[model samples]
Target: MTYLPLVNGERTYLATWMDLYSRKVVGWQVGKTMEDELVILPLRRALQWRQPVTGLIIHSDRGGQYVSAELKELL
Candidate 1:
């Protein structure tokens, strides 16, 4: 997990992603907006270091960040 100070007086949000099997942190990013794009970037980076995340169990807080329509569609 990563905590990023909000810039420009925006709200602070944490983005977390974990790899179930390895119990290792697979992806994380800190930014002002809880947009799906932000989450996808780190996920993309993590995936770059491994195989397809088809069955990977990714868990995160029930924040707007993880509940975006685009992200859910992608998932």
Candidate 2:
């Protein structure tokens, strides 16, 4: 996740999922808070849109949100 600086030094978070094979951004979401939903929502959208076959792999840095219970259930 990354942040976009707003006025007064406040920020919003952006979460994205990319198709590794195609090098295309498949899903993204932005919000005021950097919670698990930031990442989970994008992944959910990508899965619904792509509907890839079983055994697909999702890769990410070792971010705490990625290991959340909700995200694990979705995966």
Candidate 3:
């Protein structure tokens, strides 16, 4: 995740999911607030785009959103 400052002084967050081997961004979402949906939505997009089978592993920092029950259930 990354934060960007806008001209209006408010900040926006970008959440991304990248392919580890290719170093390419597979999915991404931008939101005004750092919420679980920011992370979860990108993961959902990545899954549809990549369509990987089982044993898929995801790595992320222990942010509250990343560890949320909603995200865990989806994973």
Candidate 4:
């Protein structure tokens, strides 16, 4: 996952999750605040839609949101 800052004058965040094997975006979410939900929502959506088997590996930068206790529990 990654956070992208939009160039729309006002600050906006775009969070995305990609499937490395396919090199395609599996899920995404846009929000005004850079909160944990920004990353978690996309991850939950991807899990619900793709339903990958166990032992799935998710690679992401060491952002605070990714390391949060809530997110760790979810994973």
Most TM-score-accurate candidate: 3
Residue pairs with backbone atoms closer than 3 Å in model 1 (clashes): none
**Could you give me the TM-score of model 4 versus the true structure?**
0.87
Rank the candidate models, highest TM-score first: 3, 2, 4, 1
lDDT of 1: 0.69
Q: What's model 1's lDDT at 34?
A: 62
lDDT digits (tens) for residues 1-75 of candidate 4 = 434656775667889999999998988999988899999999999989999999999888879989988889979
Tell me the tens digit of each residue's lDDT in model 1 across 1-75.
Answer: 345555666566566567777788777777766667778777777877766646766677766667887677756
List candidate 3 stretches off by more than 4 Å: none
- Using lDDT, rank the candidates from best to worst: 3, 2, 4, 1
The stretch of ten residues in a row with the least summed lDDT in candidate 1 is 1-10
Clashing pairs in 2: none
28, model 3: CA deviation in Å?
0.4
lDDT of 2 at 74: 99
lDDT of 3 at 60: 97
lDDT of each: 0.69, 0.94, 0.95, 0.86
Candidate 4, poorest ten consecutive residues by summed lDDT: 1-10
